[model samples]
Target chain A: MKQIVFQHHPGNVSSIVRGILNRLVIISFLFGSLASISFAQAENEVLSIKSPWIREAPPGIPTLAAYMEITNITESPISIIGVSSSIAKMTELHEVKLENEVMKMRKMADITLNSGQTLELKAGGSHVMLMGVQESFKQGAEIEIIFELKDLPAVKVMVPVKKDS
Target chain B: MNSILLKTLTIILGLIALGFGFWLAINQQRNTGPLISEEVGIVYPQAREIGDFQLVDFDGQPIDQQRFKDKWWLVYFGFTFCPDACPMALNDMKKIKVLFDEKIAQQVDFAFISVDPARDTPDRLKQYVQYFDPDFLAATGEMSDLQELATRVGVVFVVPENPENQNYVVDHSTFMLLWNPQVNLQAIFKAPHKPEDVVKGVKKIIAAF
Candidate 1:
């Protein structure tokens, strides 16, 4: 009887151990699925650049304007501090402003990129002012512009120089 | 008697040739005068003189009548947001610059004054001007002041109501004002003015001064 009782006790202990192992496996599986979902959500919030282009400068002129659209997918705000191009001696962020009655243009320190927002840098508005051009910007030519973003890896974009429409 | 007759005929022939030469010279003189005079057409009304006003350039520098003195200024008034006409006009101005002789260009100046000062700050004006010609200067000031100057130059500028509604457009005159060294508004050329006309007008005006 004692031998049979000991065997039953050992069986119960084994069953309890097996039950805890099963519960742990289920908990681990749930955690893995939740982690993947969070990662997918984070990946979907990447910012994108669009419609990047540059204006053709007149002959012998060393300055030009570059325009683009910045689309933010994140739920937080971002900002563009500046840009650089190998083809230009200097690149700056600029905005067209109206002081009093005159239309004026000046360099901007930074451009805000709001969450899930799109900002356009177009002619006669905000634009990237490229100065001291190293080479002539021919029509239909593709040039590379590297945009520096706040707290993110810089984005390299190819912008076409086109005739003013 | 035969010798005397021959001599008289020769004399008559000489007189006829001389008379023809005289007539040709008189006609040439009359025609040449008008040709030269017509070359100097009446100065366009808007180009007559520069009005007194204070404005700031793209660099936030103050520009007034004094800025135009001692240099030949080619001034045009337009906004940055103009899609077609303004850019076309500026391109023509650029062509005019290319057409100018290098020595003459050194003494010449170009500017684009903003008619829509409400949106065109000095900084925005600068970028637009620089895009066309790096050497070009842009200026803007109070709307009332610009209106006053535009009125004097016969330019029409009307700001649309509700400009903040995102579809606002400004209607303004399209004229290029040419000022001479004496700071006088020497002449005004209407829009769609040819680059050749600008070159010719500028050369003539510069030659006169």
Candidate 2:
């Protein structure tokens, strides 16, 4: 039995090792496929908003500016048609134009976003203006702002009140 | 190179630290603050001296360049209705106050001049300024008075083109003008202003004067 085993061994042993390696490769490939599926789930979600913060000021401030970096991840473009917040009676899309030493805050009817583009609503620039705010937006407070996009469901974003440094 | 050499180096380092600590102690006792910001603009050789104009302060007292004299003044022009820029500037000034000692704080003054006299009444101005700091003074008067002071001070402001619009906007300069005790527009600290820079600028200005 030992002589027979030795005589039949070399090719079989090599093929067995090859088979184990192939099994391991197949297992890893299966996991890779699962990861790609999860990635696709994230890819399907188009609009990604980050660092949403409400610019806080002293108390009894009537208007609060909410800033965020908005990215449209999908192939299609997105535009912001309307904005609303429970804390304010009115919300408007506004942009600040600095020229001739004047910082001009102008209201916009609608703001558009291009595909694969990022919009930064930053301080001293564009912002979502919340006027007649009922709630105090002092530092460390969280406020919800609902952005109604064209042809999309209103996405609610929780913005933290970031005090001026 | 050897333990003896290492001991010498350590002792030298100890002496340097002791010297630094002594210098800091002397500085504290003398109340001589260091200038921190490098960007304090000294543009006052041809300083646009603010022309004569009288505006009613929040206390309903008349304020000309004469009133803000004999002390350092930091003036910014904006309205109470402003959302972002105005409040941010005022907050910056408040932080500038926190950078000084009590004696220097008394010497430094933050003034907000309103372009919209129609809206910012003494009562409204008082409420707006004291909301940031009780010591801050808010002033507004006739449009001509505001324009004359703004022009000579090299600050320009204009109302939004549409007169029919009730919710109008006033486009105003955001520079925080620093005035010496002589009330000459000594420096122009342009926005976006930082608390530390403003503090250092004020200290350097005071020290140099």
Candidate 3:
């Protein structure tokens, strides 16, 4: 009985290498696709509020000042037309301006936010005026504020009141 | 081979260098003038001089320019209804008062002037300041009289239309003016001011005097 010895062909060896390479590419593609999907979900779930801070008011006074950074990441620019909170009976956009050497705080109609830009509301500058507060704003308390944007969806932010700088 | 041309070029370059040196010196001097003095025990810009004014305190007592003579006074303007910045400033001033030495404390006084005269009556002013520091004095007068005093001290106070309405608020300056015994406005401290800075500034002024 004559038994033929098995012979390895160069073409078959090249084919095996090609198949392994194709498997690696597919695995890498799958990983990359999943990573991008998770990243997108994180961005979508991010809270809309930015840099929310509060300053203390006097005793027996129900008014307080709240400041924050409002950023627009959407494709089109948006405006923060107003703010509302159940804690305060009235919430308004207030801006501090210097006229004739006097610092005047006035109610602003709206705060404009350009796409990919940020609008900062700070002390002695632009701020959110919280009037007729239903309760005292205790330090370390989380307050929820609802922002109504011009064209985009309304955003809600939980801001913690701080006592120190 | 061209000695004359080379000399001319060198001279032109030297002149340009000299001009640049002069510009640099002037710019540095302007920028550093305020900070250098403050760091080296020099008087602050706000406390360099004093202004003249006449007004009444919360008790309707006459507090003319003379009230500042021979003593140091921390004077700020606000109303009883002020919600945020005013109270913060007052509380900071109270801390400064406590930081002073007994001797300096005797020589120093804290005064709060009412920019909203219509509502900040003598009683209201008294009650408001007493809440912060019982030793602190509160003052108020006619709107025009308050404006006159405010102008002298480089302060501004404006009443919004229908400010009497419970929903409306008045806007006023956040600066605290320092006055000497001569009742002259010597220095001004900007708002969001810290108590430490104020204490240091007051000690320097007292030492200088």
Candidate 4:
């Protein structure tokens, strides 16, 4: 019935009105997509990674450690649930705890970073453990890792492989 | 009267000997202060001796306690698969060596003993430790031998009962043990050791001995 009324309408005003309505719909769709793209970028920027590097281990070694300083740039706190990388068969967040003088490596559930707080994943501390490394990462090589954040999009970083000085 | 005088002379000589012995002990105590004073590290008044163990070095050569003789050693126990604690300890060992003078550095050496012998082979240990420092001595032995060595040194370690899983992590003591030239444990630098404390503690222990 609405289509019939529009087709039978006598005035040119209705056609112009329809044209304007169609243009408005298209414009709104475009703006919606653009807003989502910017939102995704903002999510990626929530955690800032500084001086990200992977410790270059000896050849044929099956395990490696990646260290970095991660700061929450947003006003809200962010939590990292896990990490992944193509450089190894498995990637996990691990921490070295000295219990009764014994060094025990424990898996972490989530790493929480409050607003404006920096969390250091360093040696003899928390680190991203890459196990079953397929190939030896030589010095100056770059490896890509993805940090999975809770309730947010994952952040990807390119970490350089360097010998511990 | 002659007998009485002879007895008195013997008693006087005995008293003089006792006084000399007491004086000598006091002088020794004053000369040797403490093995390690204050917050450096833990140093036992008497050095503990380590038992014999059959282990292989990075070069695939069999090594026993004799390998530790004639040089000061900063010994660390861990595995090659351990990324965080193990490598950091090895790096600290390197830094401790740098803190020593060239002459003292010559007399001092570092040892990386892997408790996870099932995974860390002799060849792999060589590359792992030498990657940090070329002069690092790496070794691993059977689990029983390693356990015995750990017991002697007052440290403990637990290897995976079934290490077939390639991702198994071994738990081991992280403290750096300072061994004298006689292969005896003289001091222990606890975990998160600073290179300066290790150097200072070693020097103090070496001087005392």
Give the per-residue lDDT digits (tens) of candidate 3, residues A25-59. Answer: 66777798999999876655322457797765544
TM-score of chain A of each: 0.68, 0.71, 0.67, 0.76
TM-score of each: 0.50, 0.72, 0.65, 0.79
- The local distance difference test score of each candidate is 0.73, 0.79, 0.73, 0.85
Q: How accurate is candidate 3 locally (lDDT)?
A: 0.73
* Candidate ranking (DockQ, best to worst): 4, 2, 3, 1
CAPRI-style grade of the A/B interface in model 2: acceptable
Q: What digit string (tens of lDDT, one per residue) describes model 4 on residues A1-165?
A: 233232323468887787666666767777988999998787679988998999888777889999999999999989999899987888998887878888788788888899999988987788899999979889999999999998888999999998877
Q: Least lDDT summed over 10 consecutive residues: which range in candidate 4 chain B?
A: B32-41
- Tell me the TM-score of candidate 1's A chain: 0.68
Q: Write the per-residue lDDT of candidate 2 for residues B5-34, one digit (tens) a residue.
A: 999999999999999999999989656543
| CAPRI level of candidate 3 | incorrect
Model 4 CA deviation exceeding 4 Å by range? A1-36, A75-77, A112-118, B1-39
Model 1 lDDT tens row, B1-209: 99999999999999999999999999998644421123323364334665588888899887788888899888888777654346767888889999999877887899898877776777777777887889888898888888888877666777875654432446666667777777777766665557887787777667655
lDDT score, candidate 1, position A50: 82
Query: Model 4 clash pairs?
Result: none
Off by over 4 Å in 2: A1-45, A57-60, A86-89, A134-137, B1-42, B101-103, B161-166
Model 3 chain A poorest ten-residue lDDT run: A1-10
Q: Look at candidate 2 and tell me the lDDT of residue B25.
A: 100
Q: Candidate 3 chain B: minimum summed lDDT over ten consecutive residues — where?
A: B35-44
DockQ of each: 0.03, 0.32, 0.21, 0.53
